[model samples]
Target: MLNVLVTGGNGQLGCEIREVAPEFADKLRLFFVTRENLNLESESEIETFISANQIQAIVNTAAYTAVDLAEKEPEKARSSNVVIPKLLAKIANRHKIKMLHVSTDFAFDGKSGKPYKEDDLTSPISIYGKTKEEGEREVLKELPKAIILRTSWVYSKYGNNFLKTIRRLGKERPELKIIYDQIGTPTWARDLARVILKMIQTKDLSGFYHYSNEGIASWYDFAKEILDLSNLKTKILPIETSEYPTPATRPTYSVLNKKKIKQTLEIEIPHWKDSLKVCLSELD
Candidate 1:
């Protein structure tokens, strides 16, 4: 069996990957390690684990995902987003192991107001975005064959995510004011995990690719659907980005175009709302 090491073991993506690992048991042996245990800061630790386990492929889902806090704690973001990936790439390359690195759509400035493609110019506006973009570039520099997957608005039943926050707020608060101006697709962690598994199994596709649930939605639309599906009575108010000020400047539009990934994988992608319903059902 091919040894697959998954970083960010306790994260939503990592947990989701574990949920899907059983399906591929015949081909892969997955080892999921949390960031604390993995300790990307210690090169010796990483090297020891990879070498000892004879890890062939690494799925790096670990990242500094706190967009707002990243501004205040830029150094922390840099270490996790930039330093960790760079170190992983260097180690993975030396060991001749395939690496799959997860990135964010925040890499782009969203000035185009369209679904972003792999070749499009990146102009990150926030510290988090900047670090993640740099991480992607640095990882590719070390491992040219490494797969950099850019996904957006990720949520899942596990971990602290938008969907869970929405559900909780919907139950606690009578109303919510969500940003309607910024548009993007909400990607399910489970779907992304499955995609990663497919990529590992196929090994035919590589490089940068966008993966998110098909279709577009603003934060307001997303919240409305969440409440509507959950039978919550929360009144969702649609507001512009200016209505609610955030520490980090988000992309006005960061809907990722799935044409390349869908065509390459030759698999049908589920619509955002459909996936949302499924997730909500599972959550219930």
Candidate 2:
């Protein structure tokens, strides 16, 4: 079996990968490492692990994802979001290991009226976005073969996400207010994990691609769907982004263009609602 090293083993994406890994057992031997076990900063540690496991591939799910908090603590975010990926990319390249690095839609300012393409100009408005963009640059420079997947509005049953948070809040509150101004697709981590496995199995090496669920929605729309599907009685109110200010400014539209991934990979993507239902069903 080919050994694959997955970072951020404790995160939602990482956890989802673990859940789906059994299906790929015949081809892959995945070593999911949480931060406690795998320190990304130390080169010696990364090298030691890669050498010990004879890791042939690396799936870098680890990243600093707190958008608002990143604005306040740019240094910590930079180290985790930018430096860690860069270091890992360099190591992966040195060892000639296949690498897949996850990025976010925040890399865009959401200025594009249409969905964002892989070649679109990146103008990050927040520190988190800037750091993530920089990380992408470093990884590409160091390891051109590395597959970089940029995703948006990811939620999963495994970790603390919008769906989980809204479920809890709806149980407690009769009404919920969600931002209607910001629009994007809500990506389910399970779907993403499955796609990553496909990429690994097929040995598809597209340099840059955007992966998110089909269709578009605002935060308010997403909230209503969540409550409706979960059979919660909470009433949802539509509010503008101005009403809910955060340290990091979100894009008014960050929908990723899926044509590249769809065309290149020849894979079918599930509709956001269909995948949402499956996730909710699993959650129950």
Best candidate per lDDT, number? 1
Off by over 4 Å in 1: none
Per-residue lDDT of model 2, residues 1-284, tens digit only: 77999999999999999999999999999999988997889999999999998999999999888889988999999998889999999999999988899998999999898999999999999999999999999999999988889999999998788999999999999989999999999999999998887776566484889999999999898989999999999988999899988989989999999998998789889999999999999888
> Which digits, one per residue and each the tens of the lDDT, describe model 1 over residues 123-178?
99999999999999999999999999999999999999989999999999998999
Residue 239: error of model 1 in Å?
A: 0.7
Q: How does each model score on TM-score?
A: 0.98, 0.98
Worst 10 residues of 1 by lDDT: 197-206
At residue 165, give the lDDT of candidate 1: 96
- Residue clash pairs of candidate 1: none
lDDT of every model, 2 decimals? 0.93, 0.92
Tell me the RMSD of model 1 versus the true structure: 0.9
